[model samples]
Target: MESENVDMNIIPPQIAGGAMDAVEKRFFETEAEAKTFFENTSKRLLSVNEWGKYAGMSSFQLMDAHGIRADRTAEPGDFIRIDIPGPGTHAGMGYDWVRVKEIKELSNHEEQISYIIVQPCSHPMDKDGAIAHFFKDDATSTFIIRKFGLVVSAEEHGRNEIPNTDHGKFLDKSRNFVVGMAAKVGLSYPQWKNLVKGLLQN
Candidate 1:
């Protein structure tokens, strides 16, 4: 591929209201090596079901995260089904859902960047399901993978328009409260940190 100057800022800022960001990168001995690794990393990043494997390797057992695609491809409207612990283990209260809003890519020869942006959404199966949404609709989780020269980086940026709003039943609302507090206290950082590390891993 022929390399070109890509303006990464065009991806738009995912941060809003209260937010958190986690980034991890790995350097290769040569651009050839980075390109090879970038290809493998991209596959894992898009295979949402594999998220639990990375999260399990982290210090905290954040949740058994899983991605359920609405169609054959991982395009917009896909749903990410997360199996949280505690109350989340229950039938109606065990999951949170987010919808894939965008999947973008920009590449030339020496540089490549891909983005997967998701926002909190109502349950796909049941609009009024008892399940809770961890973040508000304005909240978004943007996952990025960039390969530039001999270096490759993975990033997770979360933006929450309102970190304190309640969006579901009492249990769902309580879950949201706990998640909001967790983000505020920095407990959610490790989960993202490990996730990005997993993406960059050889």
Candidate 2:
């Protein structure tokens, strides 16, 4: 979980993309092999349990060298990753990351595995950026978890300060709610183009 040194200073000014672009760029052994691996594995990364509290238990890069609990058990220097699941009916749900502080697993194989834990967030967009949430329904609720598979170390917000309740007030019907936040940070891109386009129309 080598993540604390992450420089939050720079923001990539591009729209976050979905569809697991193994096609556009080949990072694996071969294009077809990449596609197959991506198709099989990528969905598992984005998809979460019905409770949304934890990710599905299969695609861990590492085994048990580390554990990610909901309570901010991770330290600032630890690494974190998230699989951007989807955009709402209208937009994409971006991925998020957090840090890990302590871990019992020391083996190289175990350390590479990503930790997961689900807490509660009005928006599930990852720390990287926010995605468009274009649901017509304003009554629905979704959770944007910070550290998907981590431990809940303390009373949570108080002792660890893992962002327990930032967008929470706008939980139900959080469509415009989370999108608005992205606009302020300069992190929004193609995903955040809807309202901006409308503004330009006039």
Candidate 3:
């Protein structure tokens, strides 16, 4: 199929009964554009393009079938990175996931930003069986919200991974996104509770 931005027109079931005003998560690649969008968030919601990615697969399963083997493989500290097939239900529309190794608070442009260096488990198992490691520690694959097969004994599974491939930006911008959106509109985003009480129409 010809790849293009997912048309917001195709509404997901979650919004079938008006459960959500919209499920579109705007992402921008650059901070300036993201900020500009936020400045006028109230006028209309425009998703910023943070990053462009694809598992280079037809769908999530294509990547899995090619070379995805996270089953029982690494530890919390053991370095690991694998392309897990996104269920494509939520977590925005994207094709790739970032496997974070560790997070550090560093100063950039005099601003404190949380940065992570992850081994892109894209198929780089070293002699020691590590995808990518720029750190001193060998145990990485298991930490954070990474997806691991049964080999590592990770959580059942996660809907979203930390440091999303297209997750984009640092903490400052992230916090700003929330605060900015709120400032744009007098109301805050809907709370997750709606799903529990069935308050959401859908």
Candidate 4:
């Protein structure tokens, strides 16, 4: 009688959080493939688990060497959702939308993959520049946000950092949110118009 050994480290699909029905069904063999898909279709990259369910494959089959299956993909003219930190004194926050100027992925010093999602912001003379988020591959959960408005604002404000809880203050000193999301699922901004364009071409 031979005993079957199982690896406990492997996360099963059943525990990978149920299938993501809100996202469209798409599959890519590699990161480059995924990036190309976004460029052509203007679609956000789905998580490895989401892609697995959609493609009827396993997570192991979908993830890259870095365990990154996909990321939030956007092109210029896209309105990405960001919660701008307001003045700490008044606790007033700004739930705003900014246009995406550029989106690209790069590797960090530790060889971890990160996406540099950049959006130009005008915050008066000294603060005028792009607000970029260096979202690491492993920080998926902390990086993207689905819901917007008061609920998210409250959660962010209550985080560890006390005193100046405003995100803008941090950005002024070279800091920003782990990542900002436009929507929970799929691409953000100019949604309907882009959908129509894709459909007409197909």
Tens-place lDDT digits, model 3, residues 73-173: 22222323322222221221222223434333222232222222333342322223322211112212211111112111101111112222222234323
Clashes of each: 3, 36, 26, 1
Residue-pair clash count for candidate 2: 36
Tens digits of lDDT, candidate 1, 80-162: 77765545512233666667788778787557988888876666656555334556777778888988888889998877545
Tens-digit per-residue lDDT, 55-100, candidate 2: 2321111111142333233332333343333333222233233332
By the TM-score metric, which is better: model 1 or model 4?
1
TM-score of each: 0.80, 0.20, 0.19, 0.21
Residue 20, candidate 3: how far off, in angstroms?
Answer: 34
Q: Model 2, stretches more than 4 Å misplaced?
A: 1-76, 88-93, 105-202
What is the C-alpha RMSD, rounded to one decimal, of candidate 1? 4.6
RMSD, candidate 3, Å: 21.5
Error of 2 at 133 (Å): 15
Cα RMSD to native, each candidate? 4.6, 18.8, 21.5, 16.5
Best by lDDT: 1
- Whole-model lDDT values for every prediction: 0.67, 0.25, 0.24, 0.25
Instruction: Give the range where candidate 2 is weakest over 10 consecutive residues by summed lDDT.
Output: 151-160
Please state the error at residue 160 of candidate 4 in Å. Answer: 9.3
Which residue ranges in model 1 land beyond 4 Å of their true spot?
A: 1-6, 10-16, 57-73, 89-93, 108-110, 128-131
